[model samples]
Target: MTQPPLTTNQDLDSARLREAFGVFPSGVVAVAAIVDGAPIGLAASSFTSVSLEPPLVSFSIAATSKTWPTLRRCDHVGVTILREDHGEVCRQLAGPVDHRFDGLTCSVTGQGALTLDDGVAQFDCTIHEEVQAGDHVIVLLQLHAVAHAEASMPLIFHRSGFGRLSASA
Candidate 1:
């Protein structure tokens, strides 16, 4: 049996790469902080655990991101693993900076981390390191605190859309 021709690497562009990458479903998270006395954040689908010994987590931020510059300067960053019902909240985070947290409920730590009140889980962290990749920066965060709601289902991102997982039989 022979496989069909694959898209050539030479033709790989943003659209093609995004389409190919979107085939795999990933959980979404909200990375936020209180920057200069105000809340600021962005939604990210690239969150993952990085280390156990030092209690580290990671998420990728686009190189062109305007919010990242501000959040990175904060004393701490809040990483919220969004709940399945947070589809609208995720969109708001990606929308205009002024309206991001407009009608949302959130909590801010004394250290400046900000997390959605109803997220599946939340983490308070400080920047550990930042590694620059092709078009994004991989941020490694050192976790200082964590909280969770085990019954909550996480928001998922797949094929450039939001979704949720079904329970197994």
Candidate 2:
């Protein structure tokens, strides 16, 4: 069998790179906390588990994110893995900053971390480290506590759209 030749001279334009990156499916998470007596949060499709030894997870946020700048100052952050039915909620999160949590049910931890009530999983975490990547910052979160609804299916972001795994998957 012959392998296909790689395109060495391909132009790595932003649009092309984003389209290529969207080919892979990823789970959506809401990273939020109470900042200045209000709920501040953002939706991230780049959330991933990073380590088990120290119990860590990670998500990448654009360096220009205004929400992250404020949310990161909190002592604790709540990471909520959204359920399959949360497509609209995800959109709202990415919408206007002032209305992000409007009409949504959430729980605030004693330390002010805020998690959506209907999420598939919830994690209480603190910033462990931050790495500067190209146009983004990789945040390493050290887990303090976690809870998950085993029967709930996660919302998936794929091909620049929201979806869910089939029952047969």
Candidate 3:
């Protein structure tokens, strides 16, 4: 098949950029912690493993995110890779900050890190670095602990929506 020609002179706005970026599917994760005696978090589809030598991972937060400022104050942050059935949970995390943990079972560490009990994988991490990039900040997290379920599939985010992967052949 012939590929379409790229429009070199076309302007790329935020909406167009988002639509282009969403062409690639990504796993979604919840970055959370106990703040002011309550669970606080937000869903991020940008989560990725960054390093192995020092055990690091990363996710990006928009410059306008109100939750990051609060959650970043915690000593440790819990990163939970959402399970395939966690669409509603992800929505809750992205909803009102006060109701994020409502009706959900989560585990909290002594250091204030919090993770969903039914997540596909969980990580206890601390902020290693935060680099400002364009309209977002890339947060590098140093992993102190990790856990996973052997038979769970991860939730996927694509084209501004949540989806589950089909079983492997």
Candidate 4:
């Protein structure tokens, strides 16, 4: 018996690809879902807004993550726009979690989905669709409710660390 050789795109080193992408600054987000009376959330910098006519949003989740499978099966989910004050919360949610929402301020919708408090913006959504995208799932959502917190600066991500939008930018 012989072991199979590893393969990858010839022009791309995974580490360098990640590093280059890291240079592209992104906003911090908390994608959350409630299961069995507990909230499952993860800090993600890959979130993007897809549309506005009918209102839509999207976020990517690693396909290997068991947490996302649970979230996928959830009836509703929340996308929280983390503010500059949420750097620690971003770290907490991104960490290994037997309990991610420990003592975090949150509330539920009429459908029993979790929502974050004091975020710059919060979105309550129903999973509209999901599609495979390389090693991640691109999750599309139907916007149900939205809230805005003015006077809040955006939390940010760049090169694997937390950041805040430049007030001067």
Residues forming the 10-long window of minimal summed lDDT in candidate 1: 1-10
The lDDT-based order of candidates, best leading, equals 2, 3, 1, 4
lDDT: which is higher, 1 or 4?
Answer: 1
lDDT (CA) per prediction: 0.93, 0.96, 0.95, 0.84
For candidate 4, write residues 1-169 as lDDT tens digits. 7875645655677896899799999998888888887778798888899989778898888888878877777888888989887888888898877767877899788676677887889899999888999998998888988998878888888898877776683
The top-ranked prediction according to lDDT is 2
Residue pairs with backbone atoms closer than 3 Å in model 2 (clashes): none
Worst 10 residues of 2 by lDDT: 1-10
Q: What is the TM-score of each candidate against the true structure?
A: 0.96, 0.96, 0.96, 0.89
lDDT of 1 at 109: 93
Candidate numbers sorted by TM-score from highest down: 2, 3, 1, 4
Model 4 segments more than 4 A misplaced: 1-10
Candidate 1 C-alpha lDDT tens digits along 50-143 = 8999999999999999999888998899999999988999999999999999988899999999999999999999999999998899999999
List model 2 lDDT by residue over 1-169, tens digit each.
7886666888999999999899999999999999889999999999999999899999999999988889999999999999999999999999999999999999999998899989999999999999999999999999999999979999999999999999894
